[model samples]
Target chain A: MAFATIRDVAQKAGVSITAVSQILHGKGRFSDETKALVRKTVDELGYVPDSRAQGIRLSESRTVGLLVPDIRNPFFADLVSSMEEQLYEKGYSTLIGTSAEDVQRQDAFITTLLGQRIDGAIVVPEGADSPGIRSLIDRDLPLVFVDRTVEGLDTVPSVVSDPYPGIESAVDTLRQLGHRRVGFVAHSSLGSVNVNERETAFRAIAGELLGEDGAVVVDCDNSSRSRKDALMALLAEDATAMLCAYSPDAIALIGLLHDRGMDVGEDLSVVSFDDIDAFRLMSPQVAIISQQTADMGRQGVEMLLARIGAKRKRRAENRRIPTVFVQRGSVGVAPQAR
Target chain B: MAFATIRDVAQKAGVSITAVSQILHGKGRFSDETKALVRKTVDELGYVPDSRAQGIRLSESRTVGLLVPDIRNPFFADLVSSMEEQLYEKGYSTLIGTSAEDVQRQDAFITTLLGQRIDGAIVVPEGADSPGIRSLIDRDLPLVFVDRTVEGLDTVPSVVSDPYPGIESAVDTLRQLGHRRVGFVAHSSLGSVNVNERETAFRAIAGELLGEDGAVVVDCDNSSRSRKDALMALLAEDATAMLCAYSPDAIALIGLLHDRGMDVGEDLSVVSFDDIDAFRLMSPQVAIISQQTADMGRQGVEMLLARIGAKRKRRAENRRIPTVFVQRGSVGVAPQAR
Candidate 1:
């Protein structure tokens, strides 16, 4: 329900807007009779001075804007929840804008956040180059980029997960188990720069392990109608092991295997990136390249707050949080035990 | 990133605030030099007129507030996502407030929303008796309750899934499969009235199908450390078929069974309420009672929009969405085969 503004209270009190504003602020001169009538109208209308309205006059709303990729993904959902908890403790409320991994929507939301006069912003950028984001930087608005950062905008503070350790460990473990022909199933569609980072690391490491043939990249989007066919193609390959580069791809592959009656360990070895609850609960619980999502969220807030408070333009924080491999039962000694 | 406020432009232009406001609004008398200076300053400062700040004076902010129990729950996450998509299509942005299923948090969020001047609100109430909610009703706020309703506030609009059909089907299916002893595992600690509703329906229907002795109700919360003990107790019973009253209980049971090397459909028959992604991917997919979560969200937005545009007060919407049972592989012929 909308609260009444000073104008509404003034109209109800049959007084000038100034009279109502003055009485409400407990300032300016007014007759006792008039003040009494205004006070009564205030009580009757339940008109408390809207602090948000006051915030517009002053430039401090204590509201921060958060741009996430998507909420359906539990990883991002958990990130939002954790960040909101931290922000709430610091007397700030989060206004969420989900990009859904679309660059246009990301730019539009950036425009909206700027027009809303947000005190600060934290964006999980869709792509490196967006005019709206550039405008934010030009204005010297306190901002923190998380999950991924735009290239060449190295001066902007950001927090991104280092995908190397997890990818490295996964490669080492599979190699140790004699899986030379390991296929890397990558979802190249989601616009997160982390996808590119993982792919780079994967190709480099898989190249080192099994040469160019084994550093195979399967570009698929989880939403694609042909994803199942692509999975089948990957399955028919001579590769002894398959690593799902993302959760959605992992889920899609798992479902396809379920449909084909092919067991994970016996028929194929598999792993995925980004740990999700469902991944752990699967029969042969999937191994994953895990990110510290909560820490990423918490640090993003703390860094943004630091940016917001600093009088001098502080040096940008381009920090890399580490990822690790959480191996369950999914990856097995290669099916062809070569 | 934050944008420069009106004050910033005023200060930068070396002019009085009123002079800048008048020039920007194109109102009041101002010298041409003053107007030109303000315009140039505005361009330099990138001062886009903040419509949201303007919304402070107007009752309609083109913003709707949505309160959910928790965002970490994929169920609620999906709900928020679907609702946001609909609201976005209608050119309205949603302000999200997750209560985290805490009554205190719910109340604080309620207070925050009320002060926000949101045009309308859709709440998944934590509990019914918050004075803040009652105040929204008293103030004639266009509000819709989703997922749960207050005990006496039957006059308020609401949307909830009818748990009866799903419960009834589970009992009937298990009975037809030759299970004379069916145990029902329930979780009532979520503080939603639907918990009570499901429990009552389960006991009555399961009693009718499998006798009073077979209508075993094991009550526990998902977060409780004793959920395993409760499950062990349920196992100790002579029940051949089990019906999990909620998703968390179903998940916990599945993990426990997997850990113990007890396969579903081999050691026991199981069915759960709410269709989650992981359920279908399990070795023997768990059967479930699935709710139209997306519909619940879409309808909540439509109903709130209707309430907002209503010329006169209308009877509250006590709408009930139907739930259907999705039969997966988890359920099989009772071990005793009569």
Candidate 2:
């Protein structure tokens, strides 16, 4: 159980403790052979650098906090996984938190994160206005937003999907399939910028492609009964094609459709946001607005790193990763056309 | 942008700094009004306690490192989410890492976690042998293994699912459906104790239920080619029903079946471990061996808390949560019986 310390590595490598530290930190000049010897000995002895002490001395924790609404959502899971991978490669650990889409939880996590004194943070905000986020901004910590952005936090860089291209293409596809009525099902968290943008895009594009009256919209809370009500309202409108502003809502609707013994592609065409793995594996694959989550994760980290490394203060620009429409078996000809 | 100090909170609350500290830490007696006033002032000023300093002073970071092989796996995602929730409720922040099922990455994360001076760690290990795990044990830090365990680290408490009950019930279901041949398809990560146990249970149960030659086993290397080969080999053995030891493999197999224009419930029966959301949403729902991940997460946290709170040192005991079999449309009559 004895841990190998700097002294142990130095003794074993036949070098001074100062030399070992310099070699490990890659600071002072050392011969290649000496560096190799030190590294080999460090590996053999399993010497882990005391990053806590280093963080105190160097004023850099080399750890970044990642706050997401929920990891159970596959999109967030992929985002966390991707960011962690890239961050690890850059020699930084990830501190993770889930807001559970609750403002209190988000603030609590942010409080803890600030106490940790992490070098930076990337957040998928629970809502537009968070006192915790405000504190982060006030402290001038390197921070970036991913997938979702908050209100009044315009100066912070965000990596979000541009919903227009994907919504336009989906509506056009539905129009080409002779669908005159297109409905949008949205999560009830209307404060979310992502949801607002997606719904707005759907409303504008579906209105243009299928006429103003064709664009029906309904909101559903994250519950089976609410989702059922939303679907029923959409069906009552005689809409044969629908888009889900949220992926989980789409998944629930598909299950509801199956429960009613209605074929998805046959009875009602369906498309949802986020190209999650489940959509690809479905019997009749569900089409989606691919958000390119990998790109978002990669760029979110890059933006945060850019801020962390910035020497001069300036306005941080928001970046958008374009969302693209992916057609699959979920979208088919309208029932009336059939 | 100036952070409110503890002295500022004390002044605003009309109390001494000693009283404020005592009230905040719940360490000293204070009048109810004084406590309430201090709390309100702290909240108004957003005075977050510096946990990093507290961690050093108390030698308790109030942080737990969680290392999972891959969060993209829904099972792991759920596990991480559940554990983080429970840990946070117990007043701890989670430091997260993903090994991506690589031992080097696992060791690197372990090193970083150790350097962070976390109070404890919970790991879903990559394999049966990890030098990082050995270091953790050597350090005598409170640790718990979930879902999977290591070979040499037997004394470490593990919360894993007992595969016997689920596999036995699944085999019994297949037998009742007139399936004389059953196969178990597994990921190539046979070193994982979970995979090994499930495969073993499937072999024993299938053999006992359907006679000696009824049990067939195949391994896939997480590629379409490998999964296809495994499925073809199972079909070549005339397996009317198959259980997936790993969920992703089952998902891949289902996709492969769809690619070949085969109906899962009608043409071939499919059952997979882990009752993921996607399984329930499938047109013909996939039968599953449910691991009760929420229970596992809850119990894992409880066990870790017990270890962390134990005043007297004692050897920890391993806990097993029972797995149950759920029948759905996927398991049907054998082709021959039909």
Model 2: residues >4 Å from true position, as ranges?
A: A1-58, A189-191, A218-240, A255-268, A332-338, B1-58, B189-191, B216-240, B252-269, B332-338
lDDT tens readout by residue for model 2, B193-302: 67778888887888788899999899987666888899999999998889999887887788677667677777789999997987876657899999989899999998
**What TM-score results for chain B when candidate 1 is compared with the true chain B?**
0.78
Regions of model 1 farther than 4 Å from truth: A1-57, A107-117, A127-140, A151-155, A189-192, A209-240, A255-269, A331-338, B1-57, B115-117, B131-139, B189-192, B220-240, B258-267, B333-338
Q: Pick the TM-score winner.
A: 2
Q: For model 1, how does the per-residue alpha-carbon lDDT over A135-248 read when each residue is reduced to its tens digit? A: 567556788998888888988999989988888889889888878777777777665567777888998988987777776567777554556766767766767677777777
Q: What 10-residue stretch in candidate 1 chain A is worst by lDDT?
A: A49-58
lDDT of 2 by residue, A1-338 (tens): 23356888889889999999888767899999999999999766645444233243236667788999888889888888889888888988787888888988888777666645478899998866867877677656788989887777788889988999999999999998989989899885656767778888888888778887989899998777899999999999998988998887897898788668677888999999998987876657899999888889999999888888888775877998888999999999998887
Per DockQ, the best of the predicted structures is 2
- CAPRI level of candidate 2: acceptable
Q: What are the DockQ scores of the candidates, in order?
A: 0.20, 0.25
| Clash pairs detected, candidate 1 | none
